[model samples]
Target: MKAEKWVFGFIFVFFLVVTPIYWFMSGEIAGTFVLGFSALLGGMIATYLGLTARSFDPRPEDRDAEVVEAAGPVGFFAPQSMWPFWCAITVALIFLGPALHQAWITLVGVGFGIWALSGWVLQFYRGDYKH
Candidate 1:
């Protein structure tokens, strides 16, 4: 977490320096917006870090703590998943369909994507009770 703090500090400082350089070079209203946005983001990050600094848990003193092992596998393991393949195909079509002016193909892709996602979700609930 010390590393994270340094990283955030560096980013905040870098943005502070870059904002003015960008504003001077671009001379555009968008540069001002970017500067303001970056400042706001940096402030928020700093605030979060300040508030959460004490919440980080330190490592345990005993390095050889006994860990309890589970009796068996915890959850369902579905063997087959064609849904992912279908979802990937759907995404590809959604990306390329608009360029080809195939609106219907895009709609079909969206439908297929939804269907695949739903099937994947339902698979979690289909396990037998092992106990």
Candidate 2:
């Protein structure tokens, strides 16, 4: 986390310094905007990691150690389900909106995607998986 924070912080500073120069030299607004926005987001991420890492002791990786226990599973993961496939289908339909010349299909896909996402999120609320 410390390393991440420092790397992102460095990138943020580099972008901040180069954005104006890029805009002035190339007269291209898109690249300037992208660099500036990336810097802002990177800075935010660095700040979040910096603050969060302050609460914990350094890890084996931070100390450059080769400890096997440190590579253990962090937590259990949920079993896979079919909602992601449906979501992918919906996204594909939405992505093809312009090519298909049909916005209605995209809108319907968005609705279906939202419904599928909700079902996926609440899957454990009932039935055999209830908790």
Clashes of each: 0, 0
TM-scores of all predicted structures: 0.61, 0.70
- For candidate 2, the per-residue lDDT at 110 reads 90
Candidate 2 worst ten-residue window by lDDT = 75-84
For model 2, the superposed segments whose C-alpha errors exceed 4 Å read 64-66, 69-71, 94-111, 125-131
Candidate 1 error regions (>4 Å): 59-83, 127-131
Q: Tell me the TM-score of model 1.
A: 0.61
**Residue 37 CA displacement from its true place in model 1, Å:** 2.5
> Cα-based RMSD of the predictions, in order?
5.8, 3.2
What's the lDDT for all of these models?
A: 0.71, 0.86
Q: List the residue pairs that clash in candidate 2.
A: none
